[model samples]
Target: MTAPDLTRRLVAELVGTALLVTVVVGSGIAAQRLSPDDVGLQLLQNSTATVLGLTVLILLFGPVSGAHFNPVVSAADWLLGRRTRSGLSGAEVASYAAAQLVGGVLGAVLANVMFEVEVTRLATTERTGLPLWLGEVVATAGLVALIFALARTGRGALAAPAVGAYIGAAYWFTSSTSFANPAVTVGRVFSDSFAGIAPGSVAGFVLAQVVGGLVGVALVRYLHPEVGEAAGDVVVPHPETRSPS
Candidate 1:
């Protein structure tokens, strides 16, 4: 099969990230409106929507771009595949990250507009602190580990549902509500809704995610020393990284 060109892959990343954020922020808004007084119920509703939406998005875009939609995942892919030359090049990783970031911001704006909220307003919800940062580390570590593990184990076909399920569960288990993606964290800064995180908190969350990504990479190396052999399949076997037949 022919690999997708860089432009097409980038577009897929952009569109996929945008839609993921839309589902996240849009559902949060809807959940707030539907269950105004019950924070627990609102979170449940939001998480459910996000899980289903994310799974669908991955299935939809995985063929074209691997449906990473997260900078951490892309970076991890590059790092793991560096020695084997099976993963993305550094330039491709950069492009993917950039596209995901732009898409994330656009998705947040779209969500705010749909919910009739202020689109340009920075989030006022403060989500900083030691516990939240720790939660982010744990959440991101587990996410990266799971993704690469599946790829290495020849279970890439299950990534969509597996990733979606892990994230949905992380929402309940993690203290920080698992804002594990840097791109999404930045995107959420554009809204003041229930899902938004204040701009002030973005740096801390991003740093934690990066640290978590490193930890995840370390774990995959320790547990699956040969993971590099399947690095091209991380998240899913998209055209960009699919092995040439």
Candidate 2:
């Protein structure tokens, strides 16, 4: 795996991010429309649904590409020696990031349509700020670290379910409830539907995710120095492999 045929991975990110956000926001919209007072239950229900959807999606498509729906995951995979096989060259990363960004925006727009909202933010909706920002950093770091540990399980088929479970659990452990990916976060902005956040705050949220991603890689190195050399190294795929880890 020299460069990973990044276009494929980018397309994966695009489609995956689109689906992730659409479901999340779309559910939120449904909850609001159906029961405004039950916002909390609706969010929890939607969050749970998204986790299952993500798990299934990862299991299904993680192989066609790395399933790196987020740049953070890509960066962490590079650091962990797993994002791509050989095609993970610089071009791959950049293209994937671009596609994710575009996908995110497009997903947001689509959510707006389904929810019959314009510009995404409901105004009544507010994001948890600075403290939550730091929380994002911590939350995403834990997620990447968990990814690394499970990735080494040598069971690609289990990766998606494992990742999904981690996310579901993470919702309870962390303060911000783990937005984790800039791409997903940005897409949510267009909905103002269920889990929508203010577009104005997207920059800070992205910054936090970036920071968390790096921290996760660094933590992996610090905690498991023996495997550090393998970080981001590509491998040939097998039916057994989720994404060539």
Number of the top TM-score candidate: 1
Q: Model 1, stretches more than 4 Å misplaced?
A: 240-245
Model 2: runs farther than 4 Å from truth?
Answer: 1-4, 82-87, 119-124, 226-245
Best by lDDT: 1
The all-Cα superposition gives candidate 1 an RMSD in Å to the true structure of 1.6
lDDT of 2 at 202: 78
User: Which digits, one per residue and each the tens of the lDDT, describe model 1 over residues 1-245?
Assistant: 77888899999999999999999999999999999999999999999999999999999999888889999999999999888888888899999999999999999999998989997689899999999999999999999999999999999999999999999999999999998999999999998999999988999999999999999999988999999878888688765463333
How much is the lDDT of residue 141 in candidate 2?
85
- What tens digits encode model 2's per-residue C-alpha lDDT throughout 49-70? 7788888777655766657677
| Pairs in steric clash, model 1 | none
Note the clash tally of each candidate: 0, 18
TM-score versus the correct structure, for each prediction? 0.97, 0.83
Could you tell me the TM-score of candidate 1?
0.97
